[model samples]
Target: MIFEGYHPLDKTMFQVMDEEGNIIKPEYMPDISKEQMMEMYQLMIQTREADLKALMYQRQGRMLTYAPNIGQEAAQVGSAFPLKKEDWMVPAFRELGAWLTRGAKLEMIYLYWYGNEFGSYMPEDLKILPVSVPIASHLNHAAGIAWASKLQGKDEVTITYFGDGATSQGDFHEAMNWAGVYQVPVVFLCQNNQFAISVPRGIQTSSETIAQKALAYGMPGILVDGNDIFAMYAAVKEAFDRARRGEGPTLIEAFTYRIGAHTTSDDPKRYRSDEEVEKWKKKDPIDRMKKYLMSQGILTEEENEKIIEKAGKIAEEAFKYVEASGDTVLEDIFKYHYKEMTPQLTEQLAEYKAYLMERGEA
Candidate 1:
């Protein structure tokens, strides 16, 4: 049985494996087959490789300033893989892998980093919100969507991804309060990478744990080893089940480390020590998952190499496709905001078009 009230806040935190790669609680394990687990392991590796390659592309000036999801691969991939197609996902800037798992195209993601607004284009029925860069603002949107689904008697759930720093925002508390009051079907997945930019977790909040903060909201708050795929998946799956069963919202604090800079624009080396980074590197999610797969005899050296090579090739092709797509058109910017442009905007567009014409640049 899944243990309850293990944490002081009475939140049920279940972790199957420890940092040393030992399975501590086999009974609470997910019902996934070994083959499936290996497949997920491969996917996680592919995601890591893709993330690294994308970062390199950004450094080479091929893409816009990008957020690296290097250390949070398990948190993103494991939690995202269990989500159904009907479930909606609202993500922060550092969720490219989760976005990809939710049916987002690599080409589209590349276009997004290449500075195209149309990169937000998803299929009409795909249940994904556009990337929210304004921190915790999307938490309210996720709660609202879940509340609407509850009102309409739809079983669809919504999951919102944010960082540890986002928890300090008023919007986060408001969203949690509303979700708790309305019993909305939402999961607040906070990937606590331990740092909000240069600020450490200790400086961000006075609370002992981010998960415990959910106690005041009258919802279940789970803390899991974010680097462990099994733990992340189990926590998220349980939360999703609770939401679907109309048990209101669940807050999940995935305790992982941010291995790289906050983004391509910021440098972590200035504030944090290399020793600290090295410590987290030992618990690398990709390496951990690969080790588990190897231990289970589900993956071989040749197969792993082939998987990485294939993902690299795909990443390269996506880069090529994005580079060939050219720059965004000036008119395209006027198309998204409103169905009909206001008089002021119309005048502005006309003036811009005239200026372009005068310069023979239209």
Candidate 2:
């Protein structure tokens, strides 16, 4: 297993491909066909296009706050590609790539960012939870879902994504401890994108690596090159296999960089240096995969251009669909929280409506 070889304490990271897109560890490489690999790369392209468009929309004030998944596409897409339809994906807000991998519509993602509750409505076949914003709290929910699945003898595995800062939360420890005790089938994927919204990873915890924390919880952990899609796919595939074999949970810290700001509202220049950003840009995951695919004759310059152009159009149309959807109903905000509106909520809604009427917005 990759976890057995890449000890979290030693801090020796696993890599399947180099920054130049050459496979360094063919032994650990996944057995996916070249065509399938090309598809994964195209998915990454589609995801990047959507992310860039969403940023443009947010900047234009056409959408609400959105978490950008610019540089971490490989980590998100590779880990999610191995998941079966029955598997559950619990996402933090920035996992646009993972959501797409798990069959989420681009329009739904745009709708959610456009301030509509229907964005949270998912297809019946997909088990993805809506984007969670409260840091590491969702890990507990992932553990509980796994526990329930185990109790019912269901063959479901849960994978949850969080950032490096989330590791500092008490909920992180609590969930890990419980999952360890119960031996539930779950995978903890920490993107570890170097910073948690301007806070450096160095100050997040004293531990050398986030993956090592799994040892204390009695589960295996591995640190993989998040920029190398092959390594991410292989490591996550091994973890999911271990879970299905009833070997309990695994922790995978994908050491990648966030090339953009944490969210639309954040400013990366405030805390990080341009030199640092430029250095990591050399290790861009999407570029690495494209190089590899082109070298293998799977993608040509023209073919790649077509993919990008098509994906750009798809993203453009998805946002147009979201924009064409009329404004959300005023009652939606106060009604979904309970079976019936509470007296206080009813009064509050009335006041809000009256205020909107005064402003000609109702």
Candidate 3:
């Protein structure tokens, strides 16, 4: 197995390809079909286009604060590729590529960031949790889901995504501990994007590698090149297999970098130098994947340009659709929180509507 050779304590990432798209470890290259490879690349492109569009919308005061997943697409998309429709995905706020790969609608993503609660609603078939803004809190939710699935004798695995900073939280430890103890079929994916807002990974924890933390909880762990799609795919595919085999949780620390600000409200330049940014740009996940595809004759330069342009159009169309869906009904504000609106909420909704009617704005 792939995990047998790569230990977390090695301090070296398990990689199949280099930054220049050369397959250095051809043995570890995944068995993905060309069609799926192209789909992953397209998803990455769509993710970036959507992120850039969101940034523009936020700047123009048209959208609410959004977390961009520019540089971390490979980590998100590759890890999510192994998930079955019956499987569960619990996410932190910055996994746009993962959501897209796992069949989340682009318009839903846009609407969520547009401050609509309806955006959080996934189709019944897609077992995904809502976008959690709290750091590490959702780890517990993911663990609990896996625990329940196991208890009910269902063959389901749950995958949860969070940043490197989340490892410091008690929830992370608790979830990891519980999963390990119960041998729940869950994967803890830590997109170690080098920084947690202004704090760098070095200062976030004293451990040599985030993946190694899995050992403390009695699970297998491995570090993978987060920017290398093949590496990420191989690692997660194996992790899912182990989970399906009832071997319990595995921690995968995808060593990546966040190219944009932590969110629309923050500035990355304030804490990081342009030189460092440029250095990471050379390791762009989408670029490397495109190069690999081109080498395999699955894509050409001309076709890639067209694909990128089309992805932008898709993002634009999705956002336009979200906007065209019109504003939220004011009653939905007080109506959605409970199975039945309580008497107090009923009274407040009436009072609020009456006030709005008196002001001629209802």
lDDT of 2 by residue, 72-190 (tens): 99999999999998999988888999998888999998898899987887887899987789999999999999888888888999999999999999999999999999999999999
Per-residue lDDT of model 3, residues 297-341, tens digit only:
999999999998999999999999988983677888898788899
Considering TM-score, which of the candidate structures 2 and 3 is the better prediction for this target? 3
Q: Sort the candidates on TM-score, descending order.
A: 3, 2, 1
> Each prediction's TM-score against the native?
0.95, 0.96, 0.97
What TM-score does prediction 2 earn?
0.96
| Whole-model lDDT, model 3 | 0.93
The collision pairs in model 3 are none
The residue ranges of model 1 lying beyond 4 angstroms of the native Cα positions read 1-5, 8-13
Q: What are the Cα lDDT values of the candidates?
A: 0.85, 0.92, 0.93
